[model samples]
Target: VLCKIACMSRSRFYQSFKQKLDCTPLALQQQLRIENAAERLKAGESVSQVCFSLGYANLSHFNRRFQAQFNMPPSLYSRKNISH
Candidate 1:
């Protein structure tokens, strides 16, 4: 079981995983969105649309975290995606 293997009660496991992974369950689910967002950006989805689709309630927070993880702004990642 996820809780047992994770070595915590269900609530504690969820909380611990969230802190460890830097995101909630839904947010982790939307890591799939991050992958898709990157791909869609490569194929030419606008950044704002990607932001919304990824459920970024705050566009600025999305941009900040994306930049933090990838070491460049999403726009630049998009451009780089185009080049590569």
Candidate 2:
């Protein structure tokens, strides 16, 4: 469904998407989830709750990926830039 919506071949999409977006399909989803977490963090939501809400079975993994993408940790981004 997502592939169809994206109007791309599975293989081509995999390569191009990674090259353009810097992540796989699922990784992109997780990245969005990380952004959502960042928003919630700014809203004074707890990291643990955000992790669970994002359906992450491994909170540590989520943190690692989120940190890897955005430089600082999700919690830090929320704490520092909540107003923005």
Candidate 3:
């Protein structure tokens, strides 16, 4: 849909997006989702709620991505933030 709106093929859009952003579209999406999820978690949302609300059906996958991005699981991150 975004590609259609931009009047470019998927591959072309990905190529241009990567060139401009220095990351692929999927990477950007994952980064954005993780960042938003982290914010919500810090704002006092439960990990499971944030995971599903962010459209991640697999809790393990969400945990791994969140851990990779922040070097800590969402639960730990949220707890640490709340303690501070």
Candidate 4:
């Protein structure tokens, strides 16, 4: 639907998106979700709240991805940033 609306083939859309953003759509989505989660966590929201609010269905998966992106668990990241 998005490709049709953009008047381009799916391949062209993906190519253009990658060229402009330097990341795949899924990668961009994950980065944005994690960044938003980090902000919410710093705003005093709980880890669970951030997880569900960001549409993650599994806590462990979210934790792994968050840790991979930020090099710490969300709880620790929140605490470390909040106390500074």
Candidate 1's residue-wise lDDT over 1-84, tens digit each?
A: 688987889899889888899887767765676777788788877788888887888878878877766788789889888734
Candidate 3: how large is its RMSD? 1.6
lDDT of 3 at 51: 96
Candidate 2, residues 1-84: lDDT per residue as tens digits? 766778987887789888998879887787787888888888878888888888888888988978988898777876887664
TM-score of each: 0.61, 0.68, 0.89, 0.89
Q: Candidate 3 overall Cα lDDT vs. reference? A: 0.93
Candidate 4 structure quality by residue, lDDT tens digits, 1-84: 768988999999989989999998789989989999999998889999989988999999999999999999998998987733
Q: Could you tell me how far off, in angstroms, the CA of residue 68 lies in candidate 1 after the best superposition?
A: 1.5
lDDT of 4: 0.92
- Which residue pairs in model 3 clash with each other? none
| Per-residue accuracy of model 3 over 1-84 as CA lDDT, tens digit each | 778989999999988988999998789999999999988987899999999999999999999999999999999999988633
Q: Name model 3 segments beyond 4 Å from true.
A: none
Tell how far residue 74 is off in model 3, in angstroms: 0.8
Supply candidate 4's per-residue lDDT for 20.
97
Where's the lowest-lDDT run of ten residues in candidate 1? Answer: 25-34
Model 4 misplaced stretches (Cα beyond 4 Å): none
TM-score, candidate 4, is 0.89
Q: What C-alpha lDDT do the candidate models reach, one value each? A: 0.79, 0.82, 0.93, 0.92
Using TM-score, rank the candidates from best to worst: 4, 3, 2, 1
Q: Return the lDDT, model 1, position 67.
A: 77
